[model samples]
Target chain A: MHKKLFIPGPVDVKEDVLQKMATAMIGHRTKDASKLQRDISEKMMKLFYTENQVLLSTSSGSGLMEAAVRSCTNKRAAVFAVGAFGKRWYDMAIANNVPADLFEVEWGTPTLPEQVEEVLKTGKYDVVTVTHNETSTGIMNPVGEIGEVVKKYPEVIFCVDTVSSAAGAKIEVDKWGIDVCITSTQKALALPPGLAICTISQKAYEAAKKVENRGYYLDLVKLYDYIQKKDHQYPSTPSLSHMFALDYQLDKILAEGLDNRFKRHEEMANYVREWANKHFEVLPEEKYASNTLTNIKNTKDISVKELNERLAMRGYTISNGYGKLKDKTFRIAHMGETTLPEIKELLSNIEDILGL
Target chain B: MHKKLFIPGPVDVKEDVLQKMATAMIGHRTKDASKLQRDISEKMMKLFYTENQVLLSTSSGSGLMEAAVRSCTNKRAAVFAVGAFGKRWYDMAIANNVPADLFEVEWGTPTLPEQVEEVLKTGKYDVVTVTHNETSTGIMNPVGEIGEVVKKYPEVIFCVDTVSSAAGAKIEVDKWGIDVCITSTQKALALPPGLAICTISQKAYEAAKKVENRGYYLDLVKLYDYIQKKDHQYPSTPSLSHMFALDYQLDKILAEGLDNRFKRHEEMANYVREWANKHFEVLPEEKYASNTLTNIKNTKDISVKELNERLAMRGYTISNGYGKLKDKTFRIAHMGETTLPEIKELLSNIEDILGL
Candidate 1:
């Protein structure tokens, strides 16, 4: 039906981005391929607002998040959770047998600075992971404030998952002392899935060297060294098609201006939030609501599945509440290449479906 | 110019295969996505000639190779190397801090069955890795003989990398007693870069249970467990576009018949070898020559770079020898969807350009 996607990720990719993926295959070790990879890495660093080395992976954003925690947590890790995604970091830690503890907030609440300070002062952890944006609850953590507290723990590596927020929000990665900032292509980058990119600091690299059993594939130190030696080519082959599309999309983002892109996301987010508040309660606190997506409490108790079914019939689709919030709250993603006009049309379709 | 790719990997992708990657994105957790993933896995098992579980990764074949070594090597590993890719397995072990030792044969020599017997007699290693085809040396090891020897040592986990030969040659993975068989899309699978598929056996899963620090993402144990739990969906997000293309291509391969595909590859290999032997020395022993590619030693000591340049002008591209062998030999790949007619054309072009 050619439905427009307004989900948290794997959003509706632009035609230009799609075309870029159809680019002819090129030798991975060729100078041309090296140039393309190097260019993308530099552009990604700019997007991350950091001078740290940028590393690319072919797996989802969670892949790099796991890599950061597994590689950089030489001693122990403190994982702070606001929602399902945050808790996943701890799960990753336990499953990989990495020593870690979790400080979890309620689903709708953000990870506060005070909480981070309490953990950091204990001197129990060599690394800490926090999600900048939680799509499950439409909550964005107070990373700037948390960053200040994290800075006091100089020996600890600060890893941030900006999977759903990076391009849509103002995240000063360097200022935040974020040793590893992870993101994927499917979210605010406005591209198809399958590629994860990160900026790795020297702190993270050094920490990785101390960690034994840092498995291959996502071995941060090995990847860093091979990339430097091989002119930006990975030890493992990467998704070249995704790189082609990402290079093109990043240029588009730059053309639109980073601040302008963030502002567009904010404008669309504000519109959606105001609309949701007029009809129902916002799921997250006003100050902590995510700029990329908004969760609306089903105060009126409408069937979100039914609403989305109707929206899909009209060639548009939105996401229902995730995990525990299903049916009790619904979400509308406003990030990526999605603009205010598109958000307005989506809301208008919902209004018509509900006869509001 | 649209040049024909005759390299070991990043092989020529068909236009329809490239188009499949342009398909619309879908939510990874949705029913439709699950169906796509499940269908691809089922088809992959057929291609691998195994009834075992097939796991897919967004990264290249190297990712799964690393996963196998990391997950299955709980005690110690004996890595057999004939060339670059085989040495890579040992490198992965060292990077992951796996207790392992490498058994290296000369670059063009195959790892023999007697060697496997000697290694297994020690009872010192619980896992072994053998590259079925060494693309760098144009040698295909006698894995079936090694498999028989490995079967005698029931406790040892056998991992085989068929990255360049799986679909193009006959590999009865289940009958061969291979615990983990890995291959990527770019080689004989006749697709674009990205996407690695592997089959894991029950024995390997048991071995994985005892292995710790099997980091996330490529953790074969976690992937196997999660896919079983989630009905074939990966624990992390995957490349849906690659899945689409692979699913479609697998159908094409089946329609062509596996025996016929292997025969065609053999015929192409023979034709190339005959041509290379007529004009130059064959790099590998004839008994161990790869069925997918042929390495021609530069007996004339001509400029391989200049030869490739002239060939490029004629709309074709082949690879020079890798690492230490560069300029001493050249490679021509004839696997994947590359047909005998195309092979004839490429060989003719080289003959004309080099004035053979």
Candidate 2:
């Protein structure tokens, strides 16, 4: 039996969206391919609330995260890590030989604006990276306030990993002064995993131009230039299937209205948090908690594995805690098209299974 | 209204195989994902005829092509370029700041074994890249013979871009002493674009270990280690949809028998070549011709654009020459599930359209 995915990503894609993946292939270099990408880029601009040039990659969000650090950081990078995904950017910087420093807070904490200001004032970093929503921690960083601090540092490029929060939350890329905002099809987009998208500001592109050795496949400068040169085409053969599904899904997202989508996510998230606090306890502070997924503290210390196994029998799946948090805290994602009533149903089922 | 893709990639996939792309989502962290990847890897090992570890990337063949050069090359690389794809590896090397030199042969010419031997004998290169088949030129290099030369140079890591050739042609990766052999789903594999698969030998991994700063995402060593540590799970989320389709398609490929599939490709290629030779003349030498696609010299100076427009009306499409060869030659691909009769039918349509 196919379990309904309430996990962080690879969320249960709708039937129509899944069928778009089965559309017949088209040549990536053709005019039709260009049109498909152009359409996606325009819709993505709406999702990001930016006029920044958007780039698509046939990769996970990690791909563009690596690209952002390797391409824009000329001197050093300040990676503010509230959780695992934030530290991954730091890891990418180090792996690519891009000098970087990681300022990590407690797992459930969010990277505050003052913390970013303190790091930026050091002048050791020309590029700053922050995870808008840390999937591992369920803490949403205050990027808007952080961007106000970043705006003071004219030399520093503010890059955000909105991988798990995009479309589910209101991320004002232009208003936030986010030079690069990275995301993927999975997570809140409610599509299957494959394509990674990022909004690239002209400032980020300029910074990237100064930084040599950006590496092929992930070079933002080249990617930006190539699209202009080739009429909205990527450097490599992108996943046309993903583009088809993404374009179709984007239309559905627009139809529902962005405000309605965000409100739905917020409502579901608040419900999950309230239930968690009533039955157990929420992991992250309620004020800083993510609107997409809730990381619940296991105050009952129940066997998450056993619960998941039982949930599988019920044809549903939620995530066990990530990394060190395993069994200590479990995660229930409410993003994508997951409705509040559906969230309540899963919680009720969990209560029945555990006798909470 | 879908034109049968006869271009280099994004080939027309079978309806059932395409439907596999719509397979319901599974968490990348799940045991089920591991099984899917593990099954695909084993089947891929069989496809490449290698015992080397297989790594899958949610990217185009170019993504892995960039990875191979970036990860394993510590010393200068000798890139042998027969066509555009070959030059791309050199471009990748340069983009990543890897010291490399390009040895470019004339377009439509194959990278000869002796040429590789000469470069290796110089002792200036510890890594050498060769395109197994130049898709632009429709010329398949004698990689088996080049492998014999490569085996003599123990210090040199032999990397082959079999992006357009792997399943459609015989590639004994072990026998060829290839450190890395890369291919994507869209070409001869007859799946939609997105995933890139490559085999990494122990030598290549050891070389990667010696090499400093292999960037993340495309980092082969990290990818190798993560799968080993996490029970075949990738460090990043992979395209589960592609994996689902690829696994199903591999079974279909195997069911048809590898030899039978290759023979079918060869027969179709032969028929296209024969038809082209009688009318317009094959672009590459008949001996060095590709067993997947045939590039025909436009000696008659007929309009390829017009020919394709007519062919598109009949639910068929072919490629004009790539890059500089545009207008001078036109190509008809016979790879994937394209049959001998289909090739004849396409040729008959061309004859009728052009009054050949």
lDDT per residue for candidate 2 within A1-356, as digits (tens), equals 99988899979999999999999998888899899989999999999999999999899999999999999999999999999999999999999999999999999988999998888988888999999999898999999999999999999999999999998999999999999999999999999999999999998899899998889999999899988899999888999999999999999999999999999999999999999999988988988999999999999989999999999999999999989998999999999999998998899999999998
> What fraction of the reference interface contacts is present in each model, in order?
0.69, 0.94
The per-prediction tally of clashing pairs is 0, 0
Candidate 1 Cα outliers beyond 4 Å, as residue runs: none
Alpha-carbon DockQ of candidate 2: 0.92
Q: lDDT tens string, model 2, B223-263?
A: 99987898999999999999999999999999999999999
**Each candidate's iRMS in angstroms?**
1.5, 0.7
Give me the runs in candidate 2 sitting further than 4 Å from their true place. Answer: none
lDDT of 1 by residue, A99-194 (tens): 999999888999999998998888889998999999999999889889999898889899999999988998888998999999999999988889
The ten-residue window of minimal lDDT in model 2 chain A covers A116-125
Q: What is the TM-score of chain B alone in each candidate?
A: 0.99, 0.99
Q: Local error of candidate 2 at A57, Å?
A: 0.6
Candidate 2, clashing residue pairs?
A: none
Q: What's each prediction's TM-score?
A: 0.96, 0.99
DockQ of each: 0.67, 0.92
